[model samples]
Target: MATNDKQPVDPVVRARRQRIRRKRARQSVVFGVLIAAMALAALGAVAIYNGAVSMPFARGFSSTVIPADDPIVPACLVEGKEKPIGYKKVRVRVYNASERRGLAATTAKSLEERGFTILATGNVKTGVQNAKIAYGAKGVGRAYTLAAQIPGVVLQYDARTNAQIDLTVGQGFDGLIPEDEVKLETGVPMNNLPGCQPLAELTPAPAPASAAPTEDATASS
Candidate 1:
């Protein structure tokens, strides 16, 4: 016979244990709901924002926008366009191939006055019949820009060093166009590209052997 020394369980103790168990279960359920809600919110945020534009925090309203990796849109009022020829980057030399004295100096002076970096001015041994714009290596477009400076000029493709373009004044040379008439003839987006004009060969070819570009000017100076 075992001695039944253990008294009946206290009703108060049992009730307290039950209450604590119920409270613990409610707390677990609440914590699980909170975690699920947070996860869903994170997924929703990712799905909503894609690649329409960069992060909105990166810029501000009604303020000057910063440049980005890709070229800026024209509407952005930013100049991110790629130019085939940058005028300031190329070296230009003006040589007087014309019989007229001081034509080289005058041409060089004119160019210098109009934002051109003049190297040196001198005279050619044999004055050409038509003014020639000679370029070496990747100076064809620069040649075109040089050709544009003066009217009825020839383009000569020659291999030279240091000088990107040579302005050889010729017999037909009168003077640099009036400051108002210094428009460069360009059919393409950039002047460095080859158009229809055949490069300078001889005087009086009538038309260039290359593509014939409509004689349109690009600048006033």
Candidate 2:
């Protein structure tokens, strides 16, 4: 009796086997990606934890400080006119109710909180027992000046007498105010005061653009 030779597997059966192998391979790659993602997330959490615990002033620096007599006052208030040294168009003054300490850092924090970007900081000068600080703010081509006086004593008066802030916002001769309005105690209040608006908005006419030569124009001409 002749034995029947076994035929090769059918094409459909071979194709099915190949498909199953590919499916398993894809599953493995997906699983590996998920594991990597979880590990990265854990590492990020650890970094955040370390930063929060080790950071200085985690709660943020204080904006309020006791106001003292300003050192720049004598120079600025000369002849009863509060003339800024490097006068710009717009300026804003922020008052701290606490005596000055870490003033540069504090002023930076305060202005940033109020959505102002600091362009420059002036030098700090010594007073009887306090210090005077100056900084400038710029946004949308408009400039603002900020000046603060830090008192020597930290005492709380019956009313907030020592703490004062002056915000001046304007440009050129148009924004200039009278001598009395620029003073610490007598200057216009920031909230109810007029003319703190940005210069770009108030100015009606756009600056004229430079003329461009036409391509057809002769080189000699």
Off by more than 4 A, model 1 = 1-84, 161-163, 184-188, 191-221
Residues 128-211, candidate 2: write the lDDT tens digits: 233222221211112112332222211111111121222211111011223344433434332211223332223222221311
Compare the candidates by TM-score and give the number of the best one. 1
Question: On a 0 to 1 TM-score scale, where does candidate 2 land against the true structure?
Answer: 0.25
Candidate 1's residue-wise lDDT over 1-221, tens digit each? 87879889899999999999999999999999999999987776676576543554665564733221222111100122223344565567666554566777777777777667776666655446556665653565555555556766656555454346667665566666776775643343433322333333312222223221122111111
After the best TM-score superposition of candidate 2, give how far the Cα of residue 1 lies from its true spot, in angstroms: 8.8
- Which ten-residue region of model 1 has the weakest summed lDDT? 69-78
Error of 2 at 157 (Å): 15
